[model samples]
Target: GLPKSMSVLRVNDLVLAAYDSGIRRLEPRNGYSPGQQDSQQFWSAGSSKCQGWDSQGDATYQVLVQEVNASAPQAEPYYMQILKTCELDDATGTVQIATRCSLNGEDVLHYRGDQNRWFSVHPAAWRVAERWNQAAEVFGAMNHLTPQQCQSWIQSSASFIAQQTAQPTGHMALVPRTEARPRRLICHVTGFYPRPIKVTWEQGEQDALWEQLSSGILPNGDHTFQIQVSIELGQEGAGPTEHVCVVRHSSLANTTLRVTWDSQPTVQTVTMEIVVGCLLTALGVGALGWYLRKK
Candidate 1:
């Protein structure tokens, strides 16, 4: 739950969890990336009907974004939906690529490109580069934005002034994994924007340092982004006892992923053997007592 003094934000990654604050989670308005020419669209097959396996159709894309106000832990989710159309000219052997980028019926940019036959860059090529640059810019911005920044915006923004602050009402409990072989655990944080939050492992209250590895953001096709954090677990014979994944937000309370060690099957079997030995000894003594009484 959100503390009385602080605010709350209801974040959604679609991994499945309940809201901690009172804010209801609403779907976003837009998240579709601009559809550029020569860009492939991937789709999942329907249950019974036919379509080319996953990559058959021309690219038609939609973007979905779900954001929470920083001050409230459980607030209604802010929704953003981006719808894009990719128009191309295949008859003339030239690519005329145009992407109409809009948010809730509002235009952001009309990404346009033309594929030239001679030395000029193709429209598709240009559009691809442009889109990449835009995504890169967003990635850059994530580093600078924090929860506190969001809290400040909430106070002045017309959209947020009437909003209720959601509190951090719940937590994520870790599902333990046990195997003798070397295994790795990877978790991706979803429903975060500007990607400023930092993820790390902690033992109780203190910082637990593991090997520092690579971390980055990947597009989920729906304008929203997923941040992936990976860690190697338990070396040979040195089992890890406890670890937690902490997500630090600027304005909202931090989220913790708590995990405990799984019980070893081998240990359980050894304990069972000891119990069986004790039972056998007891039975033998009972038989001896009965025989002596009969004599």
Candidate 2:
């Protein structure tokens, strides 16, 4: 009677396990696997207990399905989903847990971890929500176990988490000068992980302290991050002036990267100048030869 049901356990964005209809389903994905002894033991215990947990879940789902069918025979297809989430704030050492349920893509019930109460989102589910709230022991046990399970999972995945760090590559380019606006220099740092990074402009040996703008760190498709910093040239003129882009990130060996840009003539400009000079020289030589022959 239950419509298609699936459950997933995740840490941050990585999936640890997935189940469909109380049966474990395995597929290739960028999921975590335990390598350390402690992690291995934790994984083994959790996996071994999953079978019993699934059995209980199957029985509960059957009851819920039958109840729904009895109540609403017209709505033949019904979907019931349960989501349990535990979020941790590393800086504050705070953990927040939530238990939520949805029916046909609409939230129907939510458990308030702080207040220890279940609330109905849909009017029709008010009775069901009240019934759940009356059974405090069920949700209470889940609330108590969630934080411990999250911490254990975090500890088990520490090594794999650490391996997620990635180093960044940086580049510097000059924005084409325009009649309406001043020329600008842009520094792009890409393919980095663990987010926190600093980018600045430098002139000579010190910080430029010029007006600049930044595109805050953004995630890449490959799970890395990128950022861009740009500074106004402000009538620096055509003369050669050196500017440097300094980057600091944890992934770097020395935690620092520098890219330099100078206002020098481009290859195309230099080549054009050479061609013009040769043409002028040839014309001058021809004019002088004609003058001598006529004289």
Candidate 3:
């Protein structure tokens, strides 16, 4: 479980980082809900989708590191990516970060599960948002994700996205709880053209509750892009029959994929159970009365 007080504190810290980085108006944060992973988001704003425009105006910026690991025993591209995430809401901004070690078009190390926070605004950002997350830094440290390296990756990602047609395909699921941890609903999007995508977790047909996350656009070895969002299912009360993972990409605008939790007791089912219980109770009473009369 996350410390309730720290998520906002962490947000303040990242805010300071962005401010120090010369981003005057760029805001960063996910929807902050105490101890709930899904309710959180990276506090930046922008769109990855290229709507026939070379850039996403002033809302978008990029920092990336794509350098070959000079010391790796095998050939691979070690990459670290960061992006400002935007969503359906009119919030200010939030940043997203991700790292990977890919070889021959496949990720030798892909972040998933509890450690699975990418494009998150899904998982807690406080844990990783600081110092670009030490884990990611450690991975990038070997590859030398210096400012120069990041600049190269930024240029490469822009060039690749410009010339590519990879559109993100998303998979949504509720992961079962493990060892008392809450279950997480994860939306994994992959194979997208041009990498800039808006993955939103929506409740009931894009209702008032929605979350925006960033996967920071990483390569799939096939010249494609992949990203993900995850949130913890907190003490749900047979809840939220309607859940969806909405993927807005340049190729498929506002594309949505509905997701559901495991079989929860529906209202109809609960009513039926109550009715059966009452009938059984009545039958038992009737039998007891008849026996008393016979006695």
Highest lDDT among the candidates is held by which one? Answer: 2
Highest-TM-score candidate = 2
Report, for every candidate in turn, its global Cα lDDT versus the true structure.
0.33, 0.62, 0.39
lDDT of 2 by residue, 1-295 (tens): 5324444565644455554543444332345676555656755565555544566655545545554556665555655556676777778767787777654455666776777677777666677667777883664223333677777767677677677777877766566669987777777677777778888888777887668998666545445667778888875653115678888888786858887654435645644643554455455434323221222
TM-score of 3: 0.32
Model 1 ranges with Cα > 4 A deviation: 1-182, 203-206, 212-215, 219-224, 254-295
Could you arrange the candidates by TM-score from highest to lowest?
2, 3, 1
True lDDT of residue 151, candidate 3: 43
Off by over 4 Å in 2: 1-31, 37-94, 98-112, 115-145, 178-180, 238-241, 262-295
Residue pairs with clashing backbones, model 2: none
Worst 10 residues of 2 by lDDT: 286-295
TM-score of candidate 1 to 2 decimals: 0.29
lDDT per residue (tens digit) for residues 201-287 in model 3: 666554424334454544343335566676555656524345666677877655544434435455455446435544554554443
